[model samples]
Target: MKVYSYSFKEGDLIPTQYTCDGLDISPHISWSKVENAKSYAIIMDDPDAPIGTFTHWIVYDIPSNVLELKENFPKKSVVGNIMQGQNDFGKIGYGGPCPPRGKPHRYFFKVFALDVESLGLPAGLSREEVERFINKHTISSGFTYGLYKR
Candidate 1:
């Protein structure tokens, strides 16, 4: 799969709205050329954290045809086209970066194209576990990176 977005260009700044400086919502994401994908999954995390990898967002079971997730989605209601899993914050949905103040950190936003509609994994999984699960099930995948600093 090839992942792209309307919010920002690949390798460009992800915008303050998706960070601690703004609304802290998820930006729109899109992908194409996914092979035999029944659903899509998105995982946003910061590997540069001082302690370990930190998950910023977790979403899955997104209908393959359904592209583009609006900013700040699922804030008060289900967006109807997808389901969200818990992030490192132990909450369901998007959680923007709040890295310890200091130098800049890199956040990876990855998209996975899966052959199955559901991975059948339970919610509230850690970023490490989720990465392992996606590796086992992904048919195609792509990613974008953004940097933020205090």
Candidate 2:
């Protein structure tokens, strides 16, 4: 479970493109060492969110052969024939970080390697629920973090 992206680096400031400062779009992502994974799940969230856990992005059912997701990928859009679930913004697709106007917040980008090809979930599932679902059937997982401040 390795994660790579053109987005902000771990502990680096998130670009404005995914925040209120820009397009509010999602960054591209790729992975490796799935280790026999039949499918994959991706969840991006901010635990530093003023609310508890805030979902920024949720995607699942990615085919095992896929290695990357392009920039500005939509929540409901399919990449390599994969499907996306709901995010905390109450929409499907990636939502960039928008922390409060003071301290920087940490955004987590988590990926799950699953044994099943699909989780059979609908398009608008929340982050917590998605977390539970992924944890229930994950074979391998890994995560990277990015920071942002408003």
Candidate 3:
């Protein structure tokens, strides 16, 4: 599987509209389908955070047939069958990059193909909690990254 985004190119600078400096909305993202995938999940984070890796978004229970998450995805706990988890910002749904001044930070958007349809987890769970469940069921994964700075 390969993850990608129309909001920005892989390893390119993310546009201001998707960061704290602007709208702070979730960027449009998509991924290639993986064989035998019962469901898919996404975890976006900035490893360059001052306090270690900081999760910007956690989305799971996405239907296997779905291929993309549109721009400015609603900040909801549960939408239809998909679940959005709480980010390091203590908010539910996407939290755009807001790194401190200086060097640009790399935000990684990772997509996982799960063996199960759902992790049976509720929304609003922390990244750590959700990741624990994802790790157990993940079959294949791919990622893309964008750089951002204040």
Please list the C-alpha lDDT of all candidates, in the order they appear: 0.77, 0.79, 0.96
Give the runs in model 3 whose Cα sits over 4 Å from its true position.
none
What TM-score goes with each of the models?
Answer: 0.86, 0.90, 0.99
Best by TM-score: 3
What would the per-residue lDDT of candidate 3 be over residues 57-150, giving only the tens digit for each residue? Answer: 9999999999999999999999899999999999999999999999999999999999999999999999989999999999999999999987
Off by over 4 Å in 2: 77-80
Whichever of 2 and 3 has more TM-score, that candidate is 3
Question: Best to worst by lDDT, what's the order?
Answer: 3, 2, 1
Tens digit per residue, CA lDDT, model 1, 1-150: 567778878777778888878888888777775768888888988999987888888887778787667667774213564667778778888888788889888888788888888767666566666667677878888887777787
lDDT of model 1 at position 78: 35
Error of 2 at 63 (Å): 0.7
TM-score of structure candidate 2: 0.90
TM-score between model 1 and native = 0.86
Better of 1 and 3 by lDDT: 3
